[model samples]
Target chain A: MDRVSLIDRVSQGMKNLLVLMLVLLTGCAQQQLRGTGDLGVVIERAAGRIVVVDSSAHATLGTVEGLGDLSHASVVFSRDGRYAYVFGRDGGITKVDLLTQNIARRVVQAGNSIGGAISQDGRLVVAQNYEPGGIKVFDAETLELLADIPSTFGNNGQRSKVVGLADLPGNRFAYALFEAGEIWVADLSDPKHPQLTKYCDIGRQPYDGLVTPDGRYYLAGLFGEDGIALVDLWKPEQGARKILAHYGRGEEKLPVFKMPHLRGWAVAGGRAYLPAVGRHEVLVVDTSTWQEVGRISVKGQPVFVMARPDARQVWVNFAFPDNGWVQVIDTLDNRLIDTLAPGKAVLHLEFTPKGEQVWISARDDNRVMIYDTLTRKPVGELPAQSPSGIFFTSRAGRIGF
Target chain B: MKSLCLLMCFSLAMQASAQSTAEPTPARQHELIRLVRQDCGSCHGMTLKGGLGLPLLPDSLRDKPASSLAATVVHGRPGTAMPPWKTILAEGEAEWIVSRLLTGFPKE
Candidate 1:
């Protein structure tokens, strides 16, 4: 070959090799996703970082840092559970690659945000904002802003604070307005052109809410009212109805030291176990009938009431002063079976997919505690900094995690 | 005699306020600063502008009496999400927070 022809040929050969390498890398990435769903991320709140934990292996991987304002941070995993979309209080949405323990794409989506949800189809991600209150949707993969729906209720030109945003079937998002006392369903089937169905007068001051695991109901716990506001997403025309009206009604209640998070409602044995605000108890609701079935008295004001994967038992945490304890309730007999003091301040709980074990984050102790749910004994621990929320990727497939 | 008793009661109340708002030590002050900026910042905004809770900016709190603000921190606002911090914070610490909040919270 002539010298010039040889040079051109070599360059072309290199280009072809690059193309093949890229194709191979993409294939490997697809293969790696199969095991990624077993991964989990722990929120190092005081510090802007997350410690990736391998749930199946029960080991700490690495820490991804520099995501801002995680004081009240929460995370939702991607459909494949490879990427963790971290929602920061400073209105930042960060997409982190669990395998690499690095931030893949990060964006300050809003001014201030509490939490967010991923659509069932995994095509869209929506964040519920507190400032200039509204919901903003973005492309799941690219984090591109697709739609913006402000929480302007009734004739008011101003937006109201939004809360309790959760993902639903049919590419829809459900959230409550704290000031407007309303619930809005954002239909994102189109992704670009979104439609909203409003359920007005949904009790009052919905501090937080969540969708049932079966994706049939959306319940918001009211701060302004005594009971929970429920919506039958299957029947959007009926709007919302108040259930457990007299749950805490007319009773002399303790001063709520902290707002009980309603998102942690645990569904086990065909019943919903929710922490009652200002009450040292968990309200058991029959999901089929939507009736108040019973109440299980816990150690203190309940914070997180979570069910083991097998739905045989439920775990409960508490607000400050009583925040250092974790209580487990038996689903079969519906009684408090055990109580474990994980550490100084037991903040969050997460169970491995098959319910073989569970992880708990204790903020004061600055460590993650693992317990064998079945054995009811201490298993392991991973050191972290001011950890508050622990999220397992198994949650990606579950509704309203 | 009655007038003197009332004056003495007023002086004692003033002393309590003064004692509670007594400037914290530099180390304790740093912890207090974080408490307002992180724990309280969870809802009030890291910069204290506002989020789920209303703004705690100097401008927003300038009009609010420091005593009332201190009381809110100590006793908490009933019928609202603001919980009583008496469990974690002392009366004086709350007073200190009120004073700092009124005069622009420290960034650090």
Candidate 2:
């Protein structure tokens, strides 16, 4: 053969070898293509780590560490459910990749933080800090600082610890100040020039806040008083109004072991199920009228009154001495139906995407218990180190998760 | 013989004083550390740098009187979210927690 033809044959052979090597490399690496919808993270608070688990398989995939002070950790997922942005107690924001089960990016943005929220369009991640109280917004992709809106109040312009930060439509955020007793709605459409609407004197010490599932109403739970401050997103000119203003009136308040969380306010059957502060009862209010409709007596001071996906049943967890027990409330009848002892110090509960199973994190027991929603029996268990929060990818599609 | 008797008396006095102070057992101390790091950590923060509550770090608490801190832990501060721990802790245990807070809390 001529020299030119021989060179052509050699180049063709090299191309064939390259294709074969590519196939072998992919196969040998054992890279499995999968979706992240069934994946979730369990916050190991004491260990400052997160265990990524697959709900469909009931198995842990991998563990990611180096997250500092996850004692009050909360997580929000990317729109695609491929990433989890964990907000740590020490103001560390960690972005973990669900597919790779590793940290994508991490930043300690503040001295202290309570929780955080992702903007409506999923372009911004906001952390509410407690040290120099304010909400710092960041670019979701790079975790770069986009804006810093200090929660300044009072005559001296002292910053107040921000709480109950939630996302609204059109790239806006609604949060309450625990020390200032004020609620502020920030329009971050133009992250740099944020248009802020402040509502003052909402109540004394509004400990936490939450936005309705529809993103139309913002509610702040008062710690210093006996009511909830409600703001209609559509009607900002009217300001906030107090609902259930006399919830604990005429009754001596019991010592609250833990502050009831308002973030998980249950809305089922057109009624909102809320935990009455310092009371062993769940208050039901008509969402349309924002009026008290009923109250169900529970085992202890309810910490999380969360509704199942279908809104047919609500699960309630307690604080302190009663934390070991979990109760089920039938929303149709508005009555306590069943109670089960999951484990010691049950810290949190999360329902599956379809609400077939519920995961309960028992911190002291160092395990997470999964129970069938219909049968109300323990179906599975996963060991963890002081797990506090269980977040599923399904939250990625929900508003105000 | 006289010196031995005096040594015995001194040892007895030390034991009596230690009993009066009522230091918790090692196991109980472990539980207390976990409780303060996790439960009280809910408000004061896990590292005790504070969240909704004031910082429990040694520097922040050193200036405060140990007895007052213990009393606050046992009886809780009225009109605030701080609830009385008397239901779960005794006076001595509260004092022990206060002392630990003043000198840096232990890790779990």
Candidate 3:
């Protein structure tokens, strides 16, 4: 064995080892390369877990568990769509990583929480709580507490439950105080010191609220009365005004089995489709004038009146008993075009990014039903355990979700 | 002997009136469990710790009279959002639910 030949063989072995390491690294990178744009999460209410789903594939990717008290869980996607902030009924806020299919961080922020919202800049996450009755702002990345604003009202300093939390432009959040009957805007431009704008006496019992797509208006649905309280974000000095007041026409209201959810998608084609508090009808209001333009009778008390992405159609799901049915209305004609029973106890629904398909959660049946919006036919289904609240990554880019 | 017989008959009547004609079948009991866990769980927390409505935990309900609780379930509190369940629940089912809620609701 000559010295030059021995040295050549040793260098060749070193080269081979480097090649092997390169192959292993590329394999690991390939596993994490997929984009999260088509990802979403479905809450398995009874199990206290979330099933991460891929909308493009029409399949569930993975399940993340150990989220406490998810019975009324709502999820919000981070700006990059890589993380989903789940707000649980037990006041737990869990940040789940979509790529890793695991909980990145979990914190029980309060005794009980309703839902949450992410700031416009995506730097902060806010949880609306029922126990301490306030909004707690957290650092989105580390889940560290940043600010706590109690919904305190009255001379006795009673804290009101915060509802209808939605992020607005300029790093602000607008929410309603259920007991105080007020709408407040929290400006977090200075994350350390939050500036508050309070609008008092908005209406009686603002159950939930929604911000328009343009980020110009915030509307709160009054459960104690027959009207909606509207605040134009562009002109806060004008204060909140009641719209569609006395919509019941002095008639007694039917028993509302479940509270209706208000969201920005309720607006379609310059018309907002709102569920009448206790009536089996959906009130159509002209967005410009905020007047009750028409009423479309429905099967049962509507729980969620949402619009498709293109603003061409509106979909409605009813409360129990009638909850097994879903109704669709064509925006152009503003008439009931189709009525379909997707499954038993349809708890929630979410549309795809382009609005071609919609996913409906049938909690009692333990399955998520997918349907073709254009044909109004069942296209696919995914089995879930007592599913509720289907959320998609597309919400990350929207002003209010 | 006559007075003793009368007392026994009155007790029998009370027991018969306190319960439905017959105990709910096992299948009906399962349905009732789901209704209370999911539907009623909406306002009261699923764990029954409470949300928009008052908590229905055993401790919270133990002090209240079972009869009054059952009546509230059947008729509902008028001013509040609790809607009467007379249309959905059968006779004496409310009483059954009150008894169950007072003893810690079943998980299933």
Candidate 4:
């Protein structure tokens, strides 16, 4: 070949190489996130929008808007994964249709309903009215207030700090009081008039609690004790049993850590993982034995804990300074696999019922992050306003009020 | 008697030299200016206008006593994020910094 022809060929090859490099760089830059189920993971962006991405990690799905800012909202998917119910800390409860990606209806509830959890039947949505230390039952269909259970148990004046809520079979709900150090079991059998059956004291100011799959026992995190107390529901009179103490690995033999500040926990595969904020470590407790099996240290003040049951992987949210990243841990190996930087104050992560994907709330950035569960890659970003809490839908298309 | 008198004279001269060295000089003033621009300016703004901390300029701390300001710098106010600097800074250095903060300039 002539020299000029050879030079032209080389130039073309270089252009192709450059293109390939660009493609490779873009592919490398994209993060791997898991989806909760067959439906793409839906993330509530703090920017008052929602983004949905499918499981294959291909195709950017859609963007929806109209969630308020600074609300620290929590989104729960309906049973069929059709609609997302958003409850904000600043009194904004919105129903977003996942199919259309639109805010169907918005209503202002009482002050600072930061989080809400729907029952298995999806008829009642129980919201924690933060300031008053109580749970407000709203008609899941009408979004109307049905009942309010106040912190009327003890002499403690302020409303008990109600941080989390979980649904049990039937119309029963277990709510955690962050300040009052008690867990109240309520029967919403009659949605209009919910009754608090009994109170089990956990420890000094219990922050949150997690129940096992069998629903026989509840583990509560003591913000003060540097440990968690186990509650046996079958025997409520036994009170909360202080099971595992101090991250399972402290030289002092006593609780040297001043404030354990347990913020988030995940229970699966007969093991419970609680992120102790003051200790800056994740404590893994075996549910069957009721003992702390292991501990993993991470960055400052981890607040939200999540795990994929099939994958044996756990993710934790560090509330400040790199707020949107999660520390991934391999439970089988009991080692930190990687630090997932999702960007912008990721305060919550929830898996779909099928556990195919995970939805994340980018609280400060106002968006939700959808990740593919298997690859753990970012598939999409959803717009939301200060979205913090997340739950799955009751049904594919059911947009709860 | 002669040796004692010579020792006393030498001690007096040494004390005078020490006082002279301790006295704030123009070089020390320049150093304080550098510190104000580098250390104090970072948190309190380029003009010593406070952001998270109290303002260091004369207009912001107009009637505030130098002693109180010095005390604050040496022993940070408790129940807040401010940390005590007694461990970090020496007594004289703290006093100098506080004096500069209060007067809006170094002791010149």
Candidate 5:
């Protein structure tokens, strides 16, 4: 062996060390996301925190704190499924890392905000606000203000309460102006400067709206009347059209204790199961015809009419007095088949990805209950401080989630 | 000193008025407290700071008359999200709520 042989051997050793370093770096990057969509988060309202749960094992992972005013909290998952963006009732938007069970970034974007949506491209986050009435868009990465679209109504520069905010395909957002009786769409492809389009006469007092699974249509619920406004995203020129024209015609409206959250309503089996406000019934609408096909009589005023992931059954919960009861409607027959007494003040329910089980939050009971959808039996329970909403990360890939 | 005297007198007057009004049963008072803290707190921040609805903090209600506040709670404002509690709360109970709210809501 000579000097030349010694130098060649040293170069080979250095190359092997560099290759080993690359392999270790790749392993560290992969370990960052230790969890998957099988995990879920339950909103503990009074505690102002969220309890992360393992949906598969029906076990608690950990709890994240410092979330303010979660009484009407809602959450949306990041594209990678490793983070959840929680929208608090007090206009606080928090970016939580689900893998680590911690808050990554958080911001108070408004004085009062109901809920928000993440852009389809996963680059922008927009919150629909009540105070000063507008939608605030933020950078998904840093929670920085990206754009502001005020919901200006009338001629006096008056802003109206914006509701029914849902993200549409093509990087756009659609929501209703409760005071203006109008629906607006903002194209946020540019994020910084959004192009606006408005439909002035879409009936009265649109409370909430949701986009279809394919992101083709947006349905806005009305409070001032008995109808819903539909907007076709494929053809925005047609504007919003009213459905259920005579839904409650000639019938006197009962006093509504709490306005039903339309976000919980579902479109399944080519039909829509929406709670009829002020009525103890769930109106079944044909998705294609947009006509009321049937109605399922419930125990009380249904607040959340959610369908199973397979669209086979629809579970309904009510407001106040009737809240303690949970009603299930078989989609095949469109009738109430089973009524289960979960606990006191059953506020929300969430089905697993393939609809195997559902996690329920009983605020009065101060616990989260998981039940097998097939057997309708209790599986597990996690103690919480006044839980109101339960969200699973499997929603990351679903449209109009 | 004069302003301080007036403030003390006003506080006593309000307290006397609250006592004179219909005093809820211990159970009913407990129920009302839970309802306001949880149900009403859903929209109006749990801490009563502010949320979808405006704050019900004593500082904000201090300027307003207690009678009007009680009336608003019972009858609710028209054309707003606030629903009338007439079905659930009696007029006297609303007055009691107003009295306690003007000072400070009971945590328990």
Candidate 6:
């Protein structure tokens, strides 16, 4: 071949190599998700006995101990899919390795660090101190206190409700201040000393706010007011835009004492599943429409709702049912298929990378349970020390062991 | 009998004064009751009589300032499970709540 043709051939070869690498990475992710293809459930069993149950088979698998009395915890995994951090409602974080199935280290976080988020790097963990309503940054691997960032946006005299923290790609973090009606965005690029970048004031009551999968917009779940407020994080100066839905749309005019509470939305197949606290239903919003197109009725007080990647199925857990269980809905028909009765009150649920297993954490049971997706049955359980808000790492190969 | 009657009148006057100072309209009063009984009723007593924390009555908060009391409600004490109230109560609403509490507990 001529010199010019040879150069073009070399460039073509390099392109093929990149494509092959991409395919290999995607396959490896699928392999890690093989065992946890369904759903993993975490239950805070009565009396703080944290256990993880295979939700499909309803069998207990892993166990952890010494989550203090009244020590309800919210558990989340690192971004790189290596560590599982279980945060006690009172103020302690138990860092566990997903690979080893063991508590790698434990750190006593300050105040009531109920909600947290892992950095994109999976090296730093930032949690919201519930009581004082401050921010605590920890070294994910060492489980050591790196910094306790007191919230300036949160007034000391005001009741501070820091409900949720979400990772904004890179090392930046976003947290919700329910009391102050504000969302604090901090740059954790420097994990040691996280610098406060922006204090985006959304409105009167902000519950749980999260950036879009693409990190373009930040949406806050408003409880004190009607509808979900959207903040243009890109042009944050423009303030928040209220995306009114049927949930709390007419709340101000309704004589009935019904207000939106504990609202969450999981984006899947270009749609969002938004559910109100008191309402026994789920609002389906087409992200493209920004309009409420459909609603699904779910029995019991469904608080936390999640959807599978393909948007084929949606999982919702009750907040008030005395016994504790999850509601599974088929998105195709928008109907309730089955109720996941795990015998413990579940506060939060997370899905494995490949959308196979659903992971649930019960504050009262202090355990994490895993459920298979195919059969919707309990297969195994991971003992979490007072687990609550559960999230998993879905970066690459690191997944449920 | 006369002394008892006088005490009753004094108590009524105190309550009336409390109500007037807080400037709670009948509607606002009803809203406050609903919140105290429902939202806070789970942990704090239904009547704000203090289940998890101390009572919210005048007798309980007589020693504390209205601002301090309001602050506690807005920004729950650090290191405790008491969640901050910024999201629950607005600034004006919190101050009004504190004012109502300072005026003395209403007799149910």
Query: DockQ winner among the candidates?
Result: 2
Candidate 4 local Cα displacement, residue B108, angstroms: 40
lDDT of 1 by residue, A119-196 (tens): 998888889898768999999999999999999977858798889999988898889999899988888999888888
lDDT of 6: 0.62
Stretch of 10 with least lDDT, candidate 4 chain A: A252-261
Model 5: per-residue Cα lDDT over A1-401, one tens digit each: 99999999999999999999999999788566455779888998878899988888878888999988787789988888878999987789999987777789999987778889888988888999888699999999999999999999889999988998988888899999988999999999998889999998898888889888888888888888888899888988888899987888898666566678777558899999988977888999998999999988899988888989889999998887788999888899887888988899999999998998988889889998888998888888888888889988888777677
| Two-chain complex of model 5, DockQ on C-alpha atoms against the true structure | 0.31
lDDT of each: 0.85, 0.92, 0.91, 0.62, 0.85, 0.62
Cand. 1: chain B TM-score = 0.79
* Predicted complex 6: CAPRI docking category: incorrect
- Greater-TM-score candidate between 3 and 5: 3
Tens-digit per-residue lDDT, A173-228, candidate 4? 77677656777878888887676755556667565566555556766666555567
Which residues of candidate 6, in runs, are more than 4 Å off? Answer: A1-49, A52-62, A79-82, A98-103, A154-159, A199-201, A245-265, A321-325, A333-353, A357-401, B1-108
Which residues of candidate 5, in runs, are more than 4 Å off?
A1-33, B1-20, B49-54, B59-65
Chain A TM-score of model 2 comes to 0.94
State the lDDT of candidate 3 residue by residue for A1-401, as single tens digits. 99999999999999999999999999898586789989999999999999999998988889999999998889998999999999999999999999888899999999988999999999999999988999999999999999999999999989998999999999999999988999999999987799999999998889899999999999999988889999999988898999998899779888877888896458888899999998999999999999989999999999999999998999999998789999999989899999999989998899999899999999989999999999999999999999999999999999987
> TM-score of each model's B chain?
0.79, 0.81, 0.79, 0.59, 0.78, 0.66
Residue B96 miss distance in model 2 (angstroms)? 1.0
DockQ for all models: 0.39, 0.65, 0.47, 0.04, 0.31, 0.02
Number of colliding residue pairs in model 1: 1
Answer with 1 or 6, whichever has the higher lDDT: 1
Better of 3 and 5 by lDDT: 3
Model 2: residue B8 alpha-carbon error in angstroms: 24
TM-score attained by model 4:
0.62
lDDT of 6 by residue, A1-401 (tens): 79999999999999999999999999787556424322232534223334544444555546656654223345566655455677665566777654445678876766555556677767787777756667888888787778877765544556465755777766777776766777777887877767775555566666566666766666677765557777666776776677863465543321112222232346666777776534566777778767777778776545667776556888887644322778888877677898877656565677776678777765446566778877999877766655654444442222111
